[model samples]
Target: MIKEAIYHRPKDNFAYAYDKETLHIRLRSKKGDLTKVSLIYGDPYEWNDEGWKNSKKTMTLEGTDELFDIWFVEVKPKYKRMRYGFEIKSNENFLIYGEDGFIEKDPKNAHFYFCFPFLNENDVFNAPAWVKDTIWYQIFPERFANGNPLLNPKNTIPWGSTEPQFDTFFGGDLEGIINNIGHLTELGVNGIYLTPIFKAKSNHKYDTIDYMEIDPQFGDKKTFKKLIEVCHENNIRVMLDAVFNHSGFYFEPFQHVLEYQEKSKYRDWFHLRDIKVKALPEANYDTFAFTHLMPKLNTENEELKKYLLEVGKYWVEEFDIDGWRLDVANEVDHQFWRDFRKTVKSVKPDAYILGEVWHDSMPWLQGDQFDAVMNYPFTQAVVEYIAKDEINSEVFKHKLIKLLSNYPKNVNEYNFNLLGSHDTPRILTLCQDNKDKLKLLFLLQFSFIGSPCIYYGDEIGLTGEGDPSCRKCMVWDKDAQDTDLFTFLKKLIDLRKRYSAFGANGQFEVIESAKETNHIMYSKKTVEEQIIITINNSNSALKVHLPFDISKNESMNLWDNKPQKISEIEIEPLSFSIIKL
Candidate 1:
């Protein structure tokens, strides 16, 4: 008798929506030790009166035979009833492999995959509850552009940039962002998420000096109002960064504590006594300081709550900004988010809120405070899958499939996907300045399951790394950078926008997937349209068997510049290809 296998999703001992396009399969052999195994599909099975068939040949586990304890699979079936199973024969079934709740097993007779019809093929799931399924583009104020130099930081006053002037200002402001509204619209981004523009001692403004006012260096109340008016006029929404998690030590209200120590009446706005710091910093019964200069606000303080809430309300009612993106939100009290959601939603029901958390934020996504979370999991998953060669294509596809299934059904509707962002290394660099690989990742990010965002410079193929390396001043000299990357991003962004089926609000299903040494192939379908995305990750020319049904319509290839109507097409080595029908 073939041994049976039990699949587990991340939360516990269960995997749902097997019909969804992706899945992670694992095998723990019944023997003493088996580090590896093979998963075979398309084999026919019959028992009693029932039988099933696989559409294609088997995809073998290639790269990660030992280290990876999980098998990621991307499934694109004709209907929900796809029959599949594994052939777990490693070291005569010696070792077993299953982690993160996935059960190890010996292959049983082929199992039936009861596909869920309601499952969407394009799910842009946002993990954090505070955010909505809206489009978002992260902008760095100084490097984005120069609005009014007078509003820019003054160099004469104080010491800055402990780590290579990253903390210093290069003069970009609100006017700079407002100046380029047309640029944003052309790029197809509907919402703009700006880094801190509030009154702060540093350029990054993570150390905010005043919670209520705009930085004199970032323009005044009127400049912001004008920018908001213009953005809304163009149907471009604005989401400001609220650094409430921490404030600059120099803030006037907080200054009382810094100057007067325990005697200050405003001292209770921090959590000093709660967390131990060195001698110079005061005890933050009311607030918490992440570092000496940045003091964390004590949401427990009623007085502090009133002040922050009032300021939060003022921006929505008076200035009419869309919402806030809380920085380092994980460390902030959950009660604060609870109050924030109540207060902010009272002002603007559809107002979008986001949190800057970097891990599995399931606790926060339960619909209390945030509408969405910054999806680092998607970014890191794809990156590590491809770049690190940590997981094989089939295994990677399994991870991809489980990501959508493991979360709430609606979360698939609003995930914020990105190839690169302000804080991480650029995608172009990760691809080693290779345009083909970058193009493939770009298509996957946009087409997969999220409202994909092109980090300001990433679309233009700006190659940089680390904190300040990725954050370079936008080259006004458009001709000075990588134009091929720019054009591809533009077209890809438009493709997602034109087809609702491809955007954040649509359904997603991985159609066909194959992972080999040098190449990979996967296709996704939406109700209104279907697209086949392919990538050749190797340096040498590689051929991959596309396991998708191209018979629905005349498939058109967009990767070759002009759309080519063809029965079949091959993706060039080191290139990414997309087909829309």
Candidate 2:
């Protein structure tokens, strides 16, 4: 046995409370090193004269990555606490692994076992239930539409007349969003995540001049309230973006600091390297990524923290917004976010708090700071496999399995999954304008776990390379839109809403990944039903065989709504099939 490769811990993803009564335990071993593994667990206080009485339950091999095999098992401790150890076996060796490390035989002592002292319900990681079911549509306010051209800013250009520039504006406002409520409803989207809309000098509004007021280009508070009312009437939730990490150079306090330097009362509000602050010839003060215009806020300051906390509560307490997507959340202090959560939840207990983190965010997702983070790792994996063609099906499966293992199941459900946003190249552009490849990408995204988002024009075949180009005016001409792609996305959303097994309620497992054929098959299973999805990423047709006998059981092809009994299914190039049994 490879003793050095075996590992486990009693907290976080290794072992955690799945709910009030269940505990999930996992073990890691060198790939293909162990033939079998089982958990030997019991309440620490339940020991009698029989040398620490315990029960053994087998752990199933969850998945195998490049170097390790993850084993998992769920247990319900009779006393709500557990002392556990693992019994590992290979063809030539057997051993007991525990808190003290490997041993030749069972120690029969509770001290040698790993301990989970108790399971506290309040400590469980709980995000809002509504988030898991939501299908989010992200809107960049300045580019979506112009319902009331009267609110247009000075020098606002005609919508879609030219390619977007960094400083250009098309006068999209909240009234435009209210006018197009039918667009979201017809597409079956239940949530809309709007980019930063607070008063700012720029069209994107990430640099906040004021947090308490809506930008005039997006209308006043009354118009925003009406937009909220309309969205609620149509059963669509709204999440607004907030940029608390920095302030625009034109912001009053920032301007004051530039004018008065160290003498300003707001001098401590920002991270100024020297008493003499300057924005030209390289800023002496700290900023967001060295940008002269955006000065990073000192969130540790008590006065500034109080102001931001109020901003967090005001939206929920006054306008009744459904959620807040924190921009540059990873850059903020942990204590500030903790206080932010308490303040926001004080007014609305179930309000979703999503963070913008591009990497592993286990530190902020412990049921304290963020409900979830923007799942950029997922975006990268999908882009690499489908858009860049840099990885085969087998490598893609491995990457996904490893990602799934990094968090608890509940956290995975609330992850904000997006293909392309205002930050990256559009999905269609990334797929090289191949609608077939894009279709396959959407199939995997909507079927996989998490709350998926659709960028403003992604469903209608919008294509652009990156930042300023990705943020373009919304294409409203129905005759020019890709109607076929729109229909495909609408069907996927409808099926997600209609079926439980095809959504977040099911467990995901890899059925097969064929590198030679560039094909993959996976299943989402629940107690009552199972959904199997097959995809062919190559240019040639291929036949994928089911692992088990399906000749006797009745099955239906969910995509076409037709009954099929074939044990082997033929899939077309750059396409997929959803089968329900």
Most TM-score-accurate candidate: 2
In angstroms, give how far residue 12 of model 2 lies from its true place.
0.7
Count of residue pairs whose backbone atoms collide, per candidate:
52, 0
Alpha-carbon lDDT of model 1: 0.63
lDDT of 2 by residue, 462-559 (tens): 99989899998989999989999999999999989888877777789999997899888999888998999998999999898887677788888999
Candidate 1, after superposition: displacement of residue 337 in Å? Answer: 1.0
Error of 2 at 219 (Å): 0.2
Q: What would the per-residue lDDT of candidate 1 be over residues 1-581, giving only the tens digit for each residue?
A: 12343333332212223324543333322222333444434333333334343332333332222223333344444443334444344444432223322234423334433222233433222233333334567898867778666655666222122222475567777898898888778776778888888888776788888878888877889889999999989887888888777778788867776567767787678766632333354443434333567767787799988888887788988988887888888987888888988798788877777788788776666566677677888888788766555766666665665566445545555667777777788777887777776777777787776666677867676777777777777765677767777777778777776665555645555444556554555555656677666666666665544554556656677555465445466655667667676
lDDT of 1 at 10: 33
lDDT of 2 at 358: 97
RMSD of each: 8.7, 0.9
